[model samples]
Target: MTRPNRPVSTVRLAGRPTQRSALRRATQIAMALSGFLLWVAWHRGLMRCDTHRAADRFAEVLQRLGTTFVKLGQHLSLRADILAPDAQEALASLQANVAPFPPEQAVQEVEAALGRPWQQVFARFDMHALAAASIAQIHRAALPDGTEVVVKIRRPGAAEQAETDMRILRRIVLVMQGLVPSLRRWGLAAIVDEVAANFRYEMDLSREAASVRRFADAWRGSADIVIPDVVDGLCTPTVMVQQFSHGAHLHGLPSSTAVAAAGKLVDSYVAQIFRDGFFHGDPHPGNVFVMDDGRICLHDFGIVGRVDGNMRRALVAFALAFVEQDAEWVVDAWLDLGLLGDGTDRAVFVPVVRALVADCAQRPLKDWSLSGALAQLVAAGRTQEVRLPRDLLVLTRTLLLLEGTVRLLAPEFSIIEAISRHTTTGVFDEPKSAASQRLPYELGNAAHALPSLLARRLHSVLRQGDLLQLSIKPDARMLSGIDRLGRRVALALVTLGLYIASSLLMQHGVGPRWGDMPVLALLGYALAIRFTFSIARSRG
Candidate 1:
């Protein structure tokens, strides 16, 4: 029920609305945002003045405002780059749980989505909600065939309200960006837009059905874990139905069961992150339930996170660096991950990073200065005015959650130990040579070679001036390659020139006319289009 993500939606209003519709949306947004602000003001006296308290306050406000804002809060929880840790931590409550909407409205939503009365759709449809949440409510029911299922019904008017709220937030964020320049650096507008996309995805329940189906396909025949199967011919934009897991909730599971469950959860995440490069975005205890037979059931697909191949490699590098206690390796991993920019002050940054690695290495998992190594690294980056990417931040938050839950169930378990065992394996494909492992230390120990290396490099630099190198374009052996490149360049230039000439000829009707346009120009246009696609196909 807490599936929400990305903040980019603030600026992304749905539809090319008429002026009246725009005005109506604007008014709705204004009223909604204002009410949220009022709630914040009222709660401030009992809250801390820092960003953490502010975040908790914001979530409270969103819950009060209803589904759209609550959904927004859930997305905000993942945007660690945009918000401080305290704020992110506070927003996580949205993912943990949301207040239930009334049961009668849930029935209406089901009826509206299915285009029939609940009685017709199911042999026994439960009017009472099994669990109620911001976006949707879950209810236990059975088909005429006696197949048990849970129907997820979106809150009525969620889409319309989310769009309005997103639009209003966009306008407000833009205004704030202009008025308070610091806000622009945080990419608040982009964050809001992402949240809008998340809301939009969740608002369309069919997408969730597809996501679960794909997840199931990915893990086919895996007996250790379970992803609920979607009900065929039973999904709409506002509602979806999936086969329910007859399992104990995570809260009710014994600690002994939890220990085993935690290990399964970690292994599942490893498969999702390392093998497939796609994963369930939020793997907190709330989204997990343990069956009596001990199989783990994962719920919610609207907020899955994806890391492409390159990012997965970077994560592997980071994990390896931590295992080796190579501070420089971790720093390099951060740079490769785009969490630290080229312009960052590495001289000042290195010591701060080394200290962080040292501190985490020396401390207990529960006593780490920040949530975990990743969070502390991000925190250090924040201190040095560096910005981490949103994807890595989400991964960090995810790993931290996993670590906490694992510890609760099995205090003796260590994800770090698991990571060290896997880092040297082919699972992640990272360079595992001793040279790669001790690269920074090798450089550090080779201080005597620095002067000779610099002298040789400087001599080479003096020998090959930039202008001198450019003057010698194509060497004799490379002439064929150069010729091929030249042909591509010539083709591109010719296509552009022909395109311009055709447009001019058609505009002035300068050549033989066909349908009041120049036939020669038409021919030229056709030639340009053909060549353009030819070039694209060749590249592809």
Candidate 2:
């Protein structure tokens, strides 16, 4: 497959803006933002106010700012570590339903991308947009061979406009940092850079097409999922053509069908995160459709998340810690995952996260919410100066959107249950039963071989008459360090084994019952938590 040219750096300026034009744009943005801030202050200071209303007005201002700021708002919505819940909710509206440019401009973009007249490219191309967003708009079209497809066209001058906006934003961030030195700790510059990079990546439609292909390959043998096939040779940086999927939106499905489809949707996402380490970052209701046969169809691959191996392990550990309700383990896993900032106060951060997890764990299984707990944890991070990983933030955003979508389909559906089921089956990692069962046997074999090996070494030393002359001097601190390392490693292994066994017992419905969970499993979890606590203490 052909790939479009990838830019060396997304933040690179497309073309230098004239001094007058730059000044004018900057002045316009400053005036709009100042007005909005003043309105917010007046409304909150002098009249009845709520975050929701303020958030809505904030989103409106961003929408009015044009594509770059709209995209920024959508990006900001994903930062659970930065924005409050209401602000995130309001900013999410920027994801879709943006005003579109003229059809003539869309047509012009298609022609330019394809290097041919619009008439020569398709048998029928609808001038009307199927959907429109800040960066692009979609048009329903058919190839000369009668194959139905959708053409996604980038708005005219989107790249140049994004470049200019990003430059202004970067300068603004610098100015803010200079004025308020404390703001530098928040890494505003890094945030702006990330936004610019993401916008640039989305601008290249070819990358989105490639993402769709990868997802299709990942789910090739799955029966319950459908990824639209890309129209090869028709994809370009500005234009992407893929088979138009036919299905009802999730909201249109019956409750029964919606529940089943939601399960499959959850399963697919779990596999994407744990098995594939790649996931659809933006899975809002608009991008999800349920086919007549109940297969879930995903559209618009513009935003996707890629997790590395270490991050996947960290996430799996996090899930394990969550299920076990071991707050210390949760904090440890997060810290191990490098989610903490340099100046993070563990004394404060740990207690906040612990309280959040305990509250979530105390809820009834049917009422449990993974997304809510995660959101709270991220919000805590913001207050405690903990920096969540970018991939993690994206995952949180996916789960938040997924939860909303699932709730719309099946109000009583428990994401916690789905995640627990997958965890029990070892979809996120190695099978707990198999690993727990095999570990002891492997350790026994090693133990059985150690005596003979040690005896032989001693006999050799004696035969050489060097046994008495052999004097071993070990550093006290080194030995202490080794001992601590060994103890922690052993504790981790035992705790993991216990947790796995507990999950197995729960899965097979073994032992007595404790509110739907096996009693033995519950005990096992308790023991695992105790061991985790011991490990944490040892670290101190």
Candidate 3:
């Protein structure tokens, strides 16, 4: 097949700022205003200092800051593994509802994005918004073809503002990384980077449309889920057209039905995250509704979670470990994901793991302190020099959101029970009718034996020299290079420790140290120098 060769333009020329840049600038201004508000709230005694309901105030602050900060808060709420429970609870209360932009402005945005007059696009377009949030607002419209649908239009300047907020957020995160040594180990900076990347993709409606299609394909045969088809040729980075649905939100269902629905939702969430590994990251009540036909209608495809084949396979083991409360297996899974300290004392980690498992097991399924336990373990691990992967934080975030929604809808639903049920049938054993009659131990044995058999056969083949092999020879220079790299790594660690200790001394009055403590301002410059020299020496 012959393909046409296209001319490539490599000249770097400054052009008009993109819509994304404008949106970012707006967001930065909004964030600055938000920070000022926070200062005013603190200085004027507007912020209540009450110990109780403190979480509510925190959520309010985020909400008042606008969409980007609220979303940031929502993201933070997921890391109950890092945040205090009350703080997480407060942040989680910042729902995805904000005042709607005016109908006149809404029309302008829609017209601007579509590059046509509103009348040309729709037979009847409602001026009043159906709902509104941080980034976009919704309007009911009937297409010229007479297909009734809802149009979701990105708020004017939203992209630019979001980009700006993200930049501000990145700056804040970088400062935190430099100032708080503990935060670096928690992978906070990497998390912000991931969020920034996702936000960029999310700002494009075409990308969101593709995500919807992918989701639909993944759940083609499922009757319990409803994914709307995108109105092709009409979608753009600023606007999306999709089938409109009318149904009661999940929170309004009957208690029993809601509990059942909650169970099913949890099942769906876990299956999507661990089994399929491609899931809607935003699953709040606002993004879900229960149709008359009993199917769950999921909306909002801006943020999502994904796991490759390797992570997917590891998740099966993680689920199994959670089911059995096996600390060793869980740690192994964490290690597989690069979520543990390389030089951590295994003995120290075991006690912490044991404590965490015991804490979770002691609580009721609906009340399980999984986040608290994970948070404690994570905090303790940091004390022993552990590092967690960015994905683990994302996983923890998803679990927190899932568990919170479940608790709100059904307090009696046990996460442990739900997980055990799924592990036995969904992951460990093949599904069967009346499967409750089967012994779990028997299923587990069967599952284990297959892998054991495969391992033995592979060992026999290796013993008989049936497998090909290769060996590499290393020269003296290579050995010297390896030794030098190791020494530089050791030096970097020592420098990091000194810099960290000095930072703490300068920030807080934490007893006197041997040498005069340097200013926190100088620590960052010192770290950059140390890191650069270490790398340069290693390369030399």
- Per-candidate alpha-carbon RMSD to the true structure: 14.3, 19.1, 14.1
Angstrom error at residue 485, model 3: 16
Relative to the true structure, how large is the alpha-carbon lDDT of every model?
0.73, 0.81, 0.69
Put the candidates in TM-score order, highest first.
Answer: 2, 1, 3
Report the alpha-carbon TM-score of model 3 versus the true structure: 0.65
Per-residue lDDT tens digits for candidate 2, residues 477-516, read: 8799999999899989999999999999989999899799
Question: Residue-wise lDDT of candidate 1 within 1-540, one digit each (tens)?
Answer: 332342322222233455687677567666766676666666665563433355555666565555566677767776655568777766766532455666777787788888898899898887778986656779999998999999998766557767876887899889868977987767779878877987888778898898899888887778788888998889988789999886776665677787788778878888788877778877776787787778888888877767876788888887777767688987787667776444675555577668877777777643442236666566566655676666676677777777776766667776766655665566777435577769878877788788998898778878876524545567776997667678788899999999999999988889688887789999999999998997787661
Of 1 and 2, the candidate ahead on TM-score is 2
For model 2, the local distance difference test gives 0.81
Pairs that collide, model 3: 22-160, 23-159, 23-160, 23-161, 24-160, 24-161, 24-164, 27-161
Top of the candidates by lDDT: 2
Model 1: lDDT to the true structure: 0.73
lDDT value, residue 292 of candidate 1: 74
